[model samples]
Target chain A: GAGVSQTPSNKVTEKGKYVELRCDPISGHTALYWYRQSLGQGPEFLIYFQGTGAADDSGLPNDRFFAVRPEGSVSTLKIQRTERGDSAVYLCASSLMPNSPLHFGNGTRLTVT
Target chain B: GESVGLHLPTLSVQEGDNSIINCAYSNSASDYFIWYKQESGKGPQFIIDIRSNMDKRQGQRVTVLLNKTVKHLSLQIAATQPGDSAVYFCAEKGLDGATNKLIFGTGTLLAVQP
Candidate 1:
């Protein structure tokens, strides 16, 4: 695809269950970012990957939320023991450089029941 | 912690009219500011950006203004269209290189009415 892509446009899970959201950034892009947006609000930063390594993960809410860009091209966000408060639209973005404009995917909407 | 806020939660404007959305940030050290438009069920799309060295920047039909003294930002759309209706967010990029984070404001819902 020419743009960033995200899997499972919508995910419905039960509390205490686990879920993984995937993001495929644009080819050759070195910077990838993850953010979470609640209803009627802006996205809050989650984490960012410079390549295969995570340069920043401080925005992650807790230990239950983790993300990895193992191959430096595809990234996965893992959530353990999902809670109702975890429901939101998980967005993925990629940029040529950290300061460059970001290209975003449609996002994966997760609903915890 | 840094916080950004919008002056108005919503704004309704007639099609073909100009629309302006305002935002305020509390951080004085922020050097990069960006405006993003998010449609329903879609991720935020970058509209425009301005650095601390520049006060104004224009892109296509949109213009972004930055005022460092007051820590204010504004996004102006030349001609409002129904397709342009969406939530606009103002974000300030943290100067810290290690984090690579941008703090976003709540947002302003722009309604373009025909």
Candidate 2:
């Protein structure tokens, strides 16, 4: 079975720019999540979506970060006015349901210079 | 605040030897715990998961032991192999109205010596 897939394995942008990371969840997964991992640290929760609606967005650091899953499967994480502090690997994961074990994709590493 | 932490930053073991990784969590209300293995430049992969009600759970060559009384978690790998070398992290599911969120620990790197 196909696992969760993320596009643009690596992205480099200038500060104050905007970038979008894409995630394609598993065929039937009903839940999708986004996390950020800094150097030498564990992944930090960012946002989560159930079906087409975001179930939880509290983990999002600020208003600059926003995510959407319009068709209920493909998701996009958008960052506005990126900062060097935002440099990190952005991970995407999906599960069959809310409580199911999540399957992760080889995240998209974003670097803001 | 929900925080899960590891006891060791790194663990080195000989191939074929048993390996043990320990973790401690702060939220006693957490009922679900999971172990994940992450290789360099790759995302985390699920190893095993256990509920608070169970003290121990076993998989192919891995076992997870949980001590709720002390808020401790341990992962044991029997006959460790080089392929098992990677960073191991224990994550606890938060109960603060964000059930889908998982609080992860600062991972423990496992290096298998041949």
| iRMSD of all candidate structures | 3.4, 3.5
The number of the candidate with the highest DockQ is 2
Candidate 2 versus the native: TM-score? 0.95
**lDDT tens string, model 1, A1-113?**
58999999999999999999999999999999999988777889999899999998988999999999989999999999999999999999999988888889999999999
Query: After aligning candidate 1 to the native by TM-score, how far in Å is the CA of A79 from where it should be?
Result: 0.3
Candidate 1, position B65, lDDT: 91
Best of the candidates, lDDT: 2
lDDT, candidate 2, A22-91, per-residue tens: 9999999999999999877899999999999999899999999999999999999999999999999999
Q: Where does model 2 exceed 4 Å of error?
A: B1-8, B94-98
Candidate 1, DockQ score (0 to 1) = 0.56
Native contact recovery (fnat) for each candidate is 0.65, 0.67
For model 2, the TM-score of its B chain against the native B chain is 0.89
lDDT of 2 by residue, B5-111 (tens): 43448999999999999999879999899999999999999999999889999999999999999999999999999999999999998545556898899889999
The residue-by-residue lDDT of candidate 1 on B42-101, one tens digit each, is: 889889989899999999999999989999999999988999999999999865674578
- Candidate 2 local Cα displacement, residue A40, angstroms: 0.8
